[model samples]
Target: MPFPFFGDDKSTIARLLSTLPQTGRVEWIGLRPARREQLLTVEEATAETDRHLTGDHARPKPGGKRQITLIQHEHLAAVAGFLGLAMPLAPGRLRRNVAISGLNLLALKNRQIQIGAEVVLEITGECHPCSRMEEELGPGGYNAMRGHGGLTARIVQGGMFRVGDEVRVLEKSSA
Candidate 1:
């Protein structure tokens, strides 16, 4: 037998993407993404990470902004992604902003996800890895993630995010 609400047991989230360097310890928090404005197309949302010189997982603070190494299923738009590999690839262990074990990243393209209460995100495009992978993940990490490098999208609406929240991928398109 199998459970229903649990969805796909093979599917996992927030597995771990390297703990924020000490003082910056931010927990798994939440997995989400959004569009800049209600009108921005999924294409625009995918490029939102370009604003981040550092990489995906960037955040806006009081004066400036900081880049976040990891972005979950929805929020990936803001920072982009490196790759989504099936752990134990080789060399050392690497991490991802969001843990997508069961669902195929491509399957969600141009789709909207309902994460908990009202956090909705539009799957824009794929998140490819950069040189950073060599330093963070193991030597093989970069090659392992290749094309299936997670996803990215902009924030359509603003709200709070927390870990352990239930995420529901909707079929209708937000565009």
Candidate 2:
């Protein structure tokens, strides 16, 4: 059985809370063309509206809710602690594409945020930790990343984004 709270709970507060836009900066970028492939660290990458990164394996399904993934640099330590890891966790192992330093990814859910003044992305939802977490992060890895798994987003407007790019929330008219 699934957890009760995982299902839709239509409440005003829930709707209102997630609508707020926030800002952050791009700290790192990574790409993997296929599953189990080595992560390629890049200074910049192009985001396409029809597909993910230029070489990512999965395509946005019919709904196109997940064109990219982003993780907060701030949560690395928290996830590491949960797994009892002494060293800092690597973002590549998490299989996310972009790592941001400031804004809370969760807060941007369903909102549009611009990256480096070129690309715009809409936060789709949480990127749940996959079973691979256990294999890569060790025994308790899967569980440790439960709520800290990062976020999935779809590219709204495609453009080139590089490391050290400033990320900002887009106003309704601008988005």
Candidate 3:
């Protein structure tokens, strides 16, 4: 069957056809108590519905869209290279809570994903880069993280997840 296209825009067509859900593994986890605080790598974390991680300080009230933040492992190197860095940037330095591999976090926006065995998160929006990137990533860091800042999620179901946990995209019916 012939596929529909948006005139000569192949990128548009590709975006329209790439809605299938994806799966990835949880590569790392980070937590911090408050803004401007140092991030700590953790072996596991408890995700609470409508709240930030158990020990995190940014826990907004219920219904807050920024309950959790996630970044793709693939984008780290690209962001580093964009800043003309010689080494791969650390996930903690990016300030995102979870670093996942094997799936495009950008495409997961508006979709529901299950992490580890129980935690469920709804991709609410993009985690835009803040001024902190400038100080944390050094000069030009903010610009380097602009489009590669990863995604923000809202926890739908509370549970525990750890490093190496499998992140699965939930079906529409399950979400």
Give the winner by lDDT: 3
- Model 1: lDDT to the true structure: 0.39
Write one digit per residue (lDDT tens) for candidate 2, span 1-175: 8654455567555656645455688988999988788678889999987468886776776448888999988888899999888876888888899999889888778878899978989889999999999998889999988988999998888889999999998765533
Better of 2 and 3 by TM-score: 3
Model 3 pairs whose backbones collide: none
Candidate 3, residues 30-51, lDDT tens digits: the string is 9998877988999999998778
Q: What ranking emerges by TM-score with the best candidate at the front?
A: 3, 2, 1
Q: Which rank order by lDDT, best down to worst?
A: 3, 2, 1
Task: List residue ranges in candidate 2 displaced over 4 A.
Answer: 1-22, 173-175
- Count clashing pairs, candidate 1: 16
Off by over 4 Å in 1: 1-27, 30-96, 100-102, 173-175
* Cα-lDDT of candidate 2: 0.84
Consecutive 10-residue window with the lowest summed lDDT within model 2:
12-21
